[model samples]
Target: MSKPKENIFDFKLFKRLFEYIKPYKLVFYSLIVLVILLAAFSAATPYLTKYAIDNSIITREEKDFLFYIVMMLGILVVSTVFQLLFIYYATWLGQNLVVDVRIKLFNHLLRFKMKYYDNSSVGVLITRAVTDMERIADIFGQGLFMIVRDLLTMAVVFGVMIYLNLKLSLIVFAMLPLLLYATRLFQKYMKKAFEEVRTEVSNLNSFVQERLTGMKILQLFTRENIEYDNFKAINERHKKGWLKTVWYNSIFFPIAELSASITIGLVAWYGGLNVVLNEGGVSQGDLVAFIMFIPMLFRPLRQIADKFNTLQMGMVAATRVFKVIDTTSQIDDHGTYIAENFEGAISFDKVYFNYVEDETVLKGISFDVEAGETIAIVGATGAGKSTIINLLSRFYEIKSGMITVDGIDIKDVTLASLRTQIAVVLQDVFLFADTIMNNITLNHPEITEAQVYQAAKDIGIHDFIMSLPNGYQYNVKERGVMLSSGQRQLISFLRAYVTNPSILVLDEATSSVDSYSEQLIQNATDKITKGRTSIVIAHRLATIQKADQIIVMDAGEIVEKGTHDELLKKENGYYKNLYEVQFLKEHVA
Candidate 1:
């Protein structure tokens, strides 16, 4: 079951977010100083206007008018220069911060145990790493710096307003409480709405990603209408999420506009009374500057309220990204062994394992294969044949008991060392959409082109590759779709061989290949497994007939173990019956 799933204003989330910027502290601090200077410059503009009106424009002093004009133009030039610097540096800082964050989050994911990915969706993980990460970038690029700039601008503007005329400034500020309250309401509602929006985004992505990957099944089974209906429902939920945000925007902005308008109207009405009676000796310039200050102060308050949405979205995204970053379910790679050289001897002692509790898959099963020996595992579906292979490779943890290689406890060896010493070729071979050479060597810096060519030649696939349009450079397309199944398996064999691992695991590798490819694979198998330990899991009894030892499993237990002829000699043996049922039919056909 999924854990059921906030209040706004999470300082903890903000604290974690700001930590990313810590690496670029010099740029960040410089931005803050630039913003403070920018704010001071903006506050000076209205005062410049006031002086022009009082000392030059209205009084008809030509020299004073010229001086004020030149001074105001200089301020504008300075403000424009500062604004450009602000934009360039702010975006630079945001980009750097996110690059670091994305790398950090991705590196964190590399350490997570397989079970986390098994239970988590690729789409959700993509959302956290890519989409949510972008939102976090926006926080720095557009939200935090601008929020600081606006706040500082508002402070400086208000101070200037009070300095010009305190009575009118107080009246303008009276409208603040109403606007602040409206903004508070907006934040509360938007947090829940945006949360819904983000949740729906994950769900939608997961559904689409799954369907796209499995389009063949959907088309073959004719699930278009059913899946489309499911998609429609999810999409509607996403629509509703955004609509809730829109509804809040509709309600909140008007209240903010009304509050701002009321302050402007109050200044006009009350300032007229003062000027009429000459009550406070308020000059024409003072009243004019005071009116300009009203919006300068209040407009920022409104814009900051708007910018708060960006901040909130960022916080929401940061919370999700950090959740994955903070995950503690990890494979410990602290063992000292560094794969000095693997002898390939393997042992499974009283091993018990299960994917879920109370549903054991490998039930007290144990086995051993000496160095340079070949072991074959044959079993019915769900009898834990593949599960055993997964344990040997340490893909999944066993519930109980121990597995060892070369008399060393596998658990006490570093995962990199343990895995590097072994290679696996599964029945369903996967190849990247790249050149055959790349697929073979996987671009390992140490493996040279000559080494890859020699491995291919030794495996007898060199002539076949050379026959292609570009030989080894031919693009296999997605998952090697351009090649036959046998060709792909041959590639996997070459890949495994190039690594020269001590243990080679072929999990039903030859199951679905054509006869020609099977011949090629058999030849590759013989060449690679000459001096290495190999584990072959297959349904084809003939393939394992020459194995040094064969382990037949049934319902998670080893039912029989012996040489091929020895096991078949038993009249009522499980292997004998299985061979007659599966392998005999193939020969008869």
Candidate 2:
């Protein structure tokens, strides 16, 4: 419920946001022109009314009356045309601006380091990209430009009122201070209320998104009642935030209406008295014009406070969005090196790493894998087994030491080049809701359907895919929910195989599949890892017996390293104990 420290009216943020208008400057300048014309036409309408009354209506001149009526109708037509143009162009500009900003935000997020995602919430990010961007668009469509037009119209109306009758204009001006003070108070409280509303909106979106995503777990745990109550509390707070703004609006608008009514009453009484007594130079037309001008002048004042709030809300939203855009949590890709023909000789030399400071996950770990060698890494959970994959992929910068690929420092290679040379199949296979063929190639332009089939066939999954309802064209839906766990793993294997990367990493790839899927994975594994530089991390000991070398890790350090048979030969060795325990578990099952 605490407020953000940023000033909602900060001109620096306004200036920064205006930079997005550079591409559409032509449209923007045109919109400004239209707004000016509309304001002039609106002010002209009342003056023309006064002129028609004084010059023809009271003079019994039919010709002059008809001409003045036609003139007024013509002005109305022109004003209507300008209003339409202004509205259409303002909306077009808003949509285009938000599109540009959203694309920029998405591209920036794509480059952020894995650590950023680890600490960030997906819901908060979605709100920024979608909801906040919409608010920023309002800065152009409703906030800034609309306010400018209203103020301009007000100024033009006041000028005409003063020109016609100073005494009537003075009567209207007398009520300004009280109305201005009320608007000021409304703005002060409304700004805080708007900020709270925006914050609550973000929280509500995040809560809903997270709960829907985890609904399965919530149902499994039977915590529906508790979570629903929590949701109700958040919903109540969100409601209150909006109602606070509404309360301010309710009080301010009635006060504005009353002030306008009083100004009109005073203008009528004073101008009519002057006209009837024939003591002051107040004509019938001037009195009528003054009546019309009171509302014209006061209209903007009544609505300007609400417009300012709209502008303030936009600024608040922009602040949240720009904060994310300005984040410096991305990997530096300054390296010009491109390993076009990388040989996949990976080496981890005295590496030290920690996701959090002083909580090292890998402590001075060192290892080397020559080209075309397959290694199996085994450890108890939290023994830094998976951390190695993260470090090797350069998802996080090491606290110290170095990781090299084919004798070249990975930091000296472009991320695109480094990642292109490696393909990883994690235990949790994430398949986009797309056709199997697209998932396999990930829509890579160079990968053809025939090539995908060949890769799938090579990995022994082509037949399985063809047997599906639509074969390779079948959609897997989100996260491959449409397919069995084993089937999804096979699709994952085919995905990595089609890439033909120089290095293949299977991290817990077979940990959750059934015996039949495991057998198929074993066949695909043997075929794919043949003569390729590969690293396998698994809990199943029997599957790794043919590995070129086995590394046993304990805590953050490697405790043993050898071939499966050689490690088992050592009495009381780490690998031997792990193998025995897993072997017994499989037998019992």
> CA lDDT, every prediction?
0.87, 0.88
Flag regions of model 2 displaced more than 4 Å: 1-8, 587-589
lDDT agreement of model 1 with the native: 0.87
**What is the C-alpha lDDT profile of model 2 across 1-589, one tens digit per residue?**
9976645368898789889999999999999999889888877767877878888888878898888788889998998888888988897898898899899999999999999999988888998999888888888788888888999998888888889988888999999999999988887788889889989999999999999988989999999999999999999999999999999999999999999999999988999999899987788889998888888878888878878888878888888999999999999888889978678798999999999988999989999998989999999999999999998888999999999999999999999988988999999999999999888899899889999988877777778888999999999998788998889988888889888889999999998899888888898888888888999998775558878988889999999998988998999988888878885577567
Candidate with the greatest lDDT versus the true structure: 2
Worst 10 residues of 1 by lDDT: 3-12
Task: Determine the backbone clash count of candidate 1.
Answer: 0
> Per-residue lDDT for 445-540 in model 1, tens only?
989999999988888989999999999999999889899888899889889989988999999999989888888888888888888899999876
Count of backbone clashes, every candidate in sequence: 0, 0
What TM-score, over all chains together, does every model reach? 0.96, 0.97
Candidate 2 versus the native: TM-score? 0.97
CA deviation > 4 Å runs, candidate 1: 1-7
